[model samples]
Target: MIPRSRTVSLLVLGAICLAACSSEEQPVQKLRPLALKEQASNIVKSADGYAVTWAGVLSNANPWHFGEHVVATIVGHDAKGAEVVRMDQPLDAVPPGGSLAFTGQASATQKPAKVTIQYRPAQWRQAARIASAFQRFPTSRVQTMRQKDGAFLITGYVDNPYSVPASTLVVNALLRDKAGKLLGGGSTFVDEVQAGSPPRFILTVSGLPKGAEVAKTEITARTWGSTGRPYEDLALSGAVPVHTIKPTSEPFAVDRNTQIVSEYKQ
Candidate 1:
């Protein structure tokens, strides 16, 4: 959600400025140069296993401003190396020739049917705000499994064909057995995708405690957008076979690929 303060500022920027000058103005023209010379700082916060808050301060040549937004995502591997899911919240006005501080929240919970990504370019807001209107579908299934040597692995995907940007989605994963037993013994949090072009993804688990054995497993993934707001939820059984591979084993892993499905738009 956008902060009220920002909404007001944007309104003023758009309204007051239109009467004053929308384009070809000196203050606006100097924005690009000053932005290039601005100093920036970043901060990260965990909202859940799936989401986080990103805050920063950027100072330039003229005024002072602040920004707040939310972001979330999923990270994994493709046929190449690393894959991604992500999305970002709308930002506020920037100070001309001045400094501004901003914050936003992002998530990776595996819930939303469509993936999301953080967009920095000027054209992103219009598209995402429109995409936000898409209906979120249910995951309907989830499962997990463990390798022989104490390492853990999980895999699953949604059936929806809405085709959202790859940058939006926070994936939270947990492994369980056929009898609903905890194999890895706890839930795991993956890193944020921030922003990327994607739909298909496979991620690897790191920093497993020595001697932890994962035999069989079940999985749960919740995905969301700004403020940890869920857009999709996927829960299913038999998603992964437990006790098959060893976490210590390298060959065992996850992979995602985008398949184009056909449908008639009303």
Candidate 2:
């Protein structure tokens, strides 16, 4: 028979091994779900067959991490609920606590009555430069014009808040009706957006259904690729103030310190 002292030692060793295995087997933390803020699709008849276009905004719910290289699978369906066309489009990274506006097009021989979209889960990664998370490009002098072909032409100027120059900036515009329903969207690119001098951008939203009235417009600007080298360079440049000062509402010609100025002059 085994001695009592030896038996006790073996039991202790086995207990320690069990605890270590349990710790190693622990599961990793689960990631939060990404939100689909809005999406719109349009199918137009073409000479060859039909043209399919789609635009959407995806939001990263997790405020700390960037969603990298998300893929979207688009499936087109005919009137009888038959699949006609399928496309797999790869998109850029979605910023932390921010949204990604993306657009794509496909050709279909058969007219698709509708289309459905699905997104693969994103691989989360830490920010290359943390300050990039707070960077924003504010737009000014924004205007929307309607084309005769039932499309929208959006014109605007985007200002680079950072000291460094930002090339390849993407401008996105979303069209909405009076009832707040998303009609369609479009995207444009602007280059050489500097700190003091803003660059102009023009985006055209086409392939919209006839008689679709656009009562409101929503516009946003962001770096071409949030996790790419361009974005990381901007982030590493320097820290920018979280807030900017706006011009006061008082009239520019009115001088509030007139009394002090008069006394000093006397």
Highest TM-score model number: 2
Instruction: Please report, in order, the local distance difference test score of every candidate based on alpha carbons.
Output: 0.34, 0.82
Q: Write the per-residue lDDT of candidate 2 for residues 72-154, one digit (tens) a residue.
A: 88899999999998999887778767788887788999999988778998888766655345577889898989888777889
Show the lowest summed lDDT stretch of 10 residues, model 2.
125-134
Where is model 1 poorest over a 10-residue stretch in terms of lDDT? Answer: 232-241
Model 2 TM-score is 0.77
Q: Work out the TM-score per prediction.
A: 0.25, 0.77
How would you encode candidate 1's per-residue C-alpha lDDT over 148-180 as one tens digit per residue?
A: 644445554433323332224434333333564
Candidate 1 positional error at 90, Å: 19
Question: Best-fitting candidate, measured by lDDT?
Answer: 2
Please identify model 2 stretches exceeding 4 Å from their true place.
Answer: 1-27, 128-132, 226-229, 239-266
Kindly report which residue stretches of model 1 are placed more than 4 angstroms away from their true locations once superposed. Answer: 1-149, 159-166, 183-198, 206-216, 224-266
